[model samples]
Target chain A: MQTIGKLSAATGVKVPTIRYYEQVGLLPQPARTQGNQRLYDRRAVQRLSFIRHARDLGFPLDAVRELLGLADDPDRSCAAADAIARRQLHEVNARIQRLNALRDELERMLRHCACGTISECRVIEVLGSHAHCQGGHIEGADLAGD
Target chain B: MQTIGKLSAATGVKVPTIRYYEQVGLLPQPARTQGNQRLYDRRAVQRLSFIRHARDLGFPLDAVRELLGLADDPDRSCAAADAIARRQLHEVNARIQRLNALRDELERMLRHCACGTISECRVIEVLGSHAHCQGGHIEGADLAGD
Candidate 1:
C-alpha cells in the first residue's frame, strides 16, 4: 500500500486528477491510513494506470467510464468495445476534417495579408465579412455537448 | 437591430454563448428595449462574426480579443493581427500533431485486441498498462482546458 501522493508520483497522474477519478467513481474508494491520508493498493495502481492510458489516448471521462463498464463485463461480446472505438474514430476523423478546413482558411488569410492595418488585414477581413464564407467553420467547444 | 436570440439564430451561435461573449466583453453591451431585451446593430453582427470565425479557426478567446482590439484600432499595424494568426496556426499544428499521436496509439490498441473476455481484453489491458502506450485520440474540447 502507498499514500495517494506516492501513487500519483508512481503513476505520473496529477493529485487532483486522481482525486477527480475517485470523485467520479472511476477509482474505487481507497482505504484511509491512520493519519487520514488516502492509501492505495495494487488495484488502485492498476485502475490509475488504466485511467491514465485512456486519457492519454484522448478518451473523455464519460467514454472512459463506459469503457470501464464494458471492461468489467468480461463475458460481454467485444462488439460493444469495438463500437465505442469506431465511434471515437469517427469523431477523430471529423475533427481532422474541420481542422484541415481551418488550416486552409488560416493559410489563405495569412497568405493574402498586406500587413497594413486591421482594415487591410485579410485574416480579420475574412472573419469580419461572411459574404465570402464557404461554409466550413463552426467553432464551438463540442458539437455533441448537452 | 436583432435581439440576442435572433443574433444567435443568424450566427448559429448558442444563446448562452452569445451571453458568454457579452459577459467576456467580446460583444459590446447592447441597447435595451423597454422589455429589457438586448438589441444589436450591424456592427455588433460584424463583431460577433469576427469573433466566431476566429474561434472556429481555434483561436483562444483571449487571442480573439486581441484581434478584435486590432480591428478597432485603425492606426495599429496589421502586424499584430498577423502575429495572432501565426500563433493560432502554431496552436493548430500542435494540436494536429498531438491528435495524430493519439490516433496512432488508439489504432495500435485496437489492433492488439484478441477478442477475448474483459479479463483478457486487449483494450482494457492496453489502457491498464501505461508502458505500452505512445498516446493520441483526445477530443478537442478536453485539449482546451489543458
Candidate 2:
C-alpha cells in the first residue's frame, strides 16, 4: 500500500487533482489507514496512471470515466473505447480548425497594423469593430475556457 | 440611455456576462434608475460590443482588458496592441501544434484497433500503458482546460 503523496508521485498527478478525480467518481474510494490517511493499492496506481495518460491525450473527465468502465470489464467489446477515441479525435480536429481561423485573423490584423496610434491600430480596429473582420470568426467561443 | 436588456440586445452579450464585465471592471458601473434598474448609454453599447468581439476572437480576459485599455486612450502607441495580437497568435499556433499531435496519436490508436475485445483492445492498451505511446505525447497538458 502507498500513501496519497506516494500515489501522486508515482502517477505524476497532483494531490488535489487526485482528490478531484475521486470526487468526480473517476477514481474509486481508496482504503484509509487507522490514522485516516489515504492508502492506495497497485490497482489504484494503474488506474491513476491510465487516467493521467488519457487526460494528457485530451480526453474529458466523462470520457475517461467511460474508458475506465470499459477497462474494468475485459470481456466487453472494444468498440465503445474506439468510439470514444474517435469522438475525441473529431473534437480535436474541430478545435484545430477553429484555432487556425483565429490565427489567420490575428495574422491579418498584425500584417495590416500601421504601428501608429490606437485610433489607427489595425489590431484594435479589428477587435473594436466586427465589420473590420474578414471572416465569420465571432462564434462567441471562449478560447481560454475551452 | 437604454436598459440592461437593451444593452444585451444591442451588443449580443448575455445579461449575466455584462454584469460579470461590470464586476471585472471591464464595463463601467452604469447609471441606476430610482427603481434600482441598471441603465446604460451608447458608450456601454460600444464597449460591450468591443469586449464581445475580442472574446469571440479567442482573446483571454486579460488580453481583452489590455486591448480595451488601449482603445480607451486613442493617442497611445499601437505597438502594445500589436504585441498582444502577436502573442495571441503565438499561443494559437502552439495550441494548434499540440492538438495536431494529439490528433495524430488518436488516429494511430484507432487505426491499430482490431475490433476485438477489451482484453486485446489497442485503444485501452495504449491508454493503460504509456510504453505503447510512440511519441512524447504525455506533456501533462490538460487539453480540455486549455
Candidate 3:
C-alpha cells in the first residue's frame, strides 16, 4: 500500500486533485492506514495516471467520467469508447473552425491598423463599426464559438 | 421604440439572453412603458446588432465592453482595441493547437481499432493504457514512458 503522498509522486497528480477526484467519485475511496491516513495500491496509482492524461487531453470531467466507467467494465464493447472519442473529436473540429474564423478577422484588422496612434487606428474602426468591416472574419460568442 | 419581444425579434437574440445581456450590462436598460414593457429604439437595435456580430466573432463580454468604449470615442487610441483582438487571436490559436493534439490521438485510436472483440479492442487498449500511445501528442501531464 502507498500513502497519498506517494501516489501523488508516482502519478504526478496533485494531492488536492486526487482528493477532489475521490470527492467527485472519479476515484474510489482507498483503505486507511493505522495512522488514519489513506493508503493506495498500484492499481489506484494507474487509475490516477489515466485520469490525469485524459484531463490533459482536454476531455471534460463529464466525458472523463464516462470514459472511466467504460474502462472499468472489461466486458463492455469498445464501440462506446470510440463513440466518446468521436464526440470529442467533433467538438474539437467545431472549435477549430470557429478559431480559424477569429484568426482571419484579427489578422485582417491588425494589418489595417498599421500601428497608427490609438486615436486613428484601424483596430478601433473595426471594433467600433461592423459596417466598415467588408465582411471579414469577425464572428460568435468566444466560449460558445469554441 | 419597440417592446422586449420586438427587440428580441430584431436582434435574433433570445428574450432570456437579451435579458441576460441587459443584466450583465452588455445592453443598457431601456425606458419602460406605462404597462411596464421595456422599449428600445433604432440605436438600441443597431447596438444589439453590433454586439451580436462581435459575439459571433468570439469576443468575450469584457473585451466587447472595451470595444464598445473605443467605438464610442473615435479619438481614443485604437491600440487597445488592436491589443484585445490580438489577445483573442492568441487564445484562439492556442486552442487550435490543443485541439489538433486531441484530434491526432482520437484519429489514431479509431484507425488502429480492428473491430476486435471487446477484450482485444485497440480503442479500449489506447484509452485504457496511455502507454500504448507512442510519442507526438502527449498528455499535458507528462506520464510518457511510465
Candidate 4:
C-alpha cells in the first residue's frame, strides 16, 4: 500500500483529481492508515492509470465510466466499447470540420486585409458585417471551449 | 431604442449572455428605463453583432475584447488586429493537428478491434497499457473540454 501522494506520483494524476475520481465513482475508495491517510494498492494504481489514459484519449467522463464498467466485466461483449469509441470519433470529426471552416474564413479575412488603419481593416470589416462571411461556419460552435 | 429582449432577438445573443458581456465589460452598460428594464440603442445592436461575429470565428473572450477596443478606435493601427487573427489561426492549426493525431489513434484502435469479448478487447487492453499507445498523442490534450 502507498500513500495518496505516492499514488499520485505513480499515476501522474494530481492528488485532488484522484480524490475527485473517487468522489465521482471512477476510482474505488482506497484503504486508509491508522492516521487516516489514504492508502492505494496496485489495483488502485492500475485503475487510475486506465482512467488517465482514457481521459488522455479525449474520452468524456461518462464514456470513461461506461468503458470502466465494460472493462470490469470481461465476459461482456466488446460491442458497447466499440460503439462508444465510434461516437467519440464522430464528435471529433465534426469538431475538426468546424475548425477547418473557421480556418478558411480566417485565411480569407487575412488575405483581404490591407493592414492599413482599423477603419479600412478587412479583418474588422468582415467581423463587423456578417454578410461578408462565407456563411455556416459558426453554427453550434463551442468557441469558448475550443 | 429597444428592450433587452429585442436586442437579444436582433443580435442572436441570449439575454443572460448579453448581461454577462456587460458584466465583463465587453458590452457597455446600456441606458435603463424608470421601470428598471435594460434599454439598448442601435449602437448596442451593432456592438453586440460585432462580438457575436468574432465569437463565431472562435476568437477567445480576451481577443474579442481587444478587437472591440480596436473597432472603437478607427485611427489606431490595424496591425494589432492582424496579429491577433494570426495568433488565433496558429492556435486553431495547433488544435487541428492535435485532433488529427487523436483521430489517427482512435482509428488505429478501432481498426484493430475485433468485436470479440471484453477479455479480448483491444480497446480495453490498449487503454490498460499506455505502452501500446503511439506516444505523445495525449500530451497537453484538453480532452475533457474537447
Candidate 5:
C-alpha cells in the first residue's frame, strides 16, 4: 500500500485529478488507512497510468471511460475498442481538414498583403469580409455560451 | 440603431455570447435606450460581423482582440495584423501535425488487431506498452488541473 502522493508520483496524475476521476467514476474509490488517508495499490497505479496515457493522446474522458471498460473485460471482443479508436481517428481527421482549410486561407491572405496601412490590409480585409473567405464552415463556429 | 436582439440576428452570434464579448472587452458596450434597452448602430453590426468571421476561422479571443484593434486603427501598418494571422496559422499547423501523428498511430493499432479477446487485443496492448507505440511524445501530456 502507498499514499496518494506516492500514487501520484508513480502515475504522474495529480492528486486532485485522481480524486476527480473517482468522483467522475473513472477511478474507483480507494481504500483508506487508519488515519483516513487514501491508499492505493499496484492496480491503482496501472489503471491511473492507462487513464493518463489515453488522455495524453487527446481521447475525450467519455471515450477513455469506454476504453477502460473494454480493458477491464478481457474476455470481451476487441470490437468496441476498435470502434472507439476509429471514432477518435475520425474526429482528428475532421479537425485536420478544417485546420488545413484555415491554413490555406491565412496563407492566401498573408500573401496578398502589400504591407500597407490596416485600411488596405489583406489580413484584416479577409477577416472583415466573409465573401473573401472560401465559405467553408468550421465545425464549432459558435463560441456562444448557453 | 438596432436592438441587441437584432444585432444578434444579423451577426449569427448568440445573445449570451455577444454579452460575453462585451464583458471581456472584445465588444464595446452599446448605448442603452431611454427604457434601458441596449442599442447598436450600423458600425456595431459591422464590427460584430468582423469578430464573428475571425472567430469562425478559429482565432483565439486574444488574437481576435488584436485583430479588432488593428481594424479600428486604419492608419496603423498591417504588420501587426499579419503577425497575428501568421501566429494563428502556425498554431493550426502544429495541431494538424499532432493530429496526423495520432491518426497514424491509431491506424497502425487498428491494423495489428486480429479481432481476438482483450488478452490478445492489440489496442489494449499498444496502449499498455508505450514501447508498442511510435515513441512520439504527446504535447500537454499532463491533464492535471493547475
Candidate 6:
C-alpha cells in the first residue's frame, strides 16, 4: 500500500487533485489506514496513470470518465475508445482552425501598425472596425469550456 | 444616448456580458438617468465594440485590458499594442503545434486499434505507455487558464 503522497509521486498527479478525483468519482475511494490516511494499492497507481495520460492528451473529463469505464471492462470491444479519440481529434482540429484564423488577423494587425501613435495605429483601427474582420466570432466562452 | 440593450444589439455582446465588462472595469460606468437606468453615449458604443472584437479574437482579459488602455491614450506609442498582438500570435502558434502533435498521436492510435478487445486495444496501449506519446505533457489546467 502507498500513501497519497507516494501515489502522487508514482502517478505525477498532485495529492489534492488525487483527492479531488476521488470526490468526483474519477477514482475509486481507497482503503484507509488506522490513522485514517488514504492507502492506495497498485491498482490505484495504474488507474491514476491512465487518467493522467488521458488528461494530458486533452480529453475532456467526461471523455476521460467514459474511457476509464471502457478500460475497466477488459472484455469489452474497443470501438467506444476509438470513437472517443476521434471526437477529441475533431475538437482539436476545429480549435486549430479557429486559432489559425485568429493568428492571421493578429499578424495582419501587427504588420499594418506602422509603429505610430494610437490614433493612427492599424491594430486599433482593425479592432475597432468590424468590417476589417474575417467572418465568425470565436467566442471566448467557448474557449473557456474547452 | 443608447440603452444597454441597444448597445448589446449594436455590438453583438450580450446584455449581461456588457454589465460584466463594466463590473470588471473593461467598460466605464456609464451615466444614469433619473430612473437609475444606465445611459451610454456613442463613445461607449465604440469602446464596447472594440472590447467585443478583441475578445472574439481570443485576447485574454489582461491583454484586452492593456490594449484598451493603449487605445484610450490617443497620443501614446503603439509599441505596447504591437507587443501584445505578437505575444498572442506566439501563444496561438504554440497551441497549434501542441494540438498537431496530439492529433498525430490520436490518429495513430485510432489507425492501429484493429477493432480488437480492450486488452489488445492500441488506444489503451498507446495511452498506457508514455513512450508512445510524441513529447511534452499539455495539462488540461493550462488550457483552462488560457
| Number of the top-ranking candidate, with DockQ as the measure | 2
Alpha-carbon TM-score of each model against the true structure: 0.89, 0.94, 0.84, 0.95, 0.89, 0.93
Instruction: Put the candidates in DockQ order, highest first.
Output: 2, 4, 6, 1, 5, 3
The alpha-carbon deviation from the true structure for residue B78 of candidate 2, after best TM-score superposition, in angstroms, is 1.2
Q: Mind giving the per-residue lDDT tens digits that candidate 6 earns over B89-136?
A: 898777777777777777887888898899888898777767776564
Backbone clashes, each candidate:
6, 0, 11, 0, 0, 0
- lDDT of model 2 at residue A67? 98
True contacts kept of each: 0.64, 0.86, 0.50, 0.75, 0.67, 0.71
DockQ class, candidate 6: medium
Among these predictions, the greatest TM-score belongs to 4
* Interface RMSD to the true structure, each candidate: 3.9, 1.8, 5.7, 1.8, 4.2, 2.3
Model 4 alpha-carbon miss at residue B90, Å: 1.1
| TM (chain A), candidate 5 | 0.88
* Cα error, candidate 6, residue A33 (Å): 2.0
Clashing pairs in 2: none
All candidates: DockQ: 0.54, 0.73, 0.37, 0.69, 0.53, 0.64
lDDT of 4 by residue, A1-69 (tens): 999999998889999999999999998888889999899899999998989888877788899999999
TM-score of 1: 0.89
Residue lDDT tens for model 6, A25-71? 99998999999999999999988988988887888888999998988
What lDDT does each candidate get? 0.76, 0.88, 0.75, 0.88, 0.82, 0.84
Q: Model 3: per-residue lDDT, tens digit, A1-146? A: 99999999888788998999999999999999888999999899878877877776667788889988877787878788778778877876766665676778778878878765667777665654676665645343334522
Q: Cα deviation of B54 in candidate 3 (Å)? A: 2.2
Pull out the clashing pairs in model 1.
Answer: A58-B137, A58-B138, A74-B118, B101-B136, B102-B136, B102-B137
lDDT of 3 at B98: 65
Roughly what TM-score does model 2 have, to 2 decimal places? 0.94
Residues A1-146, candidate 5: write the lDDT tens digits: 89989998887888999999999999998899999999998899888888887776768899999999999999999988988888877876766677778778788888999989999999999888788876665634432210
Query: Of the candidates numbered 1 and 3, which has the greater DockQ value?
Result: 1
Give candidate 2 misplaced runs (Cα > 4 Å).
Answer: A142-146, B142-146
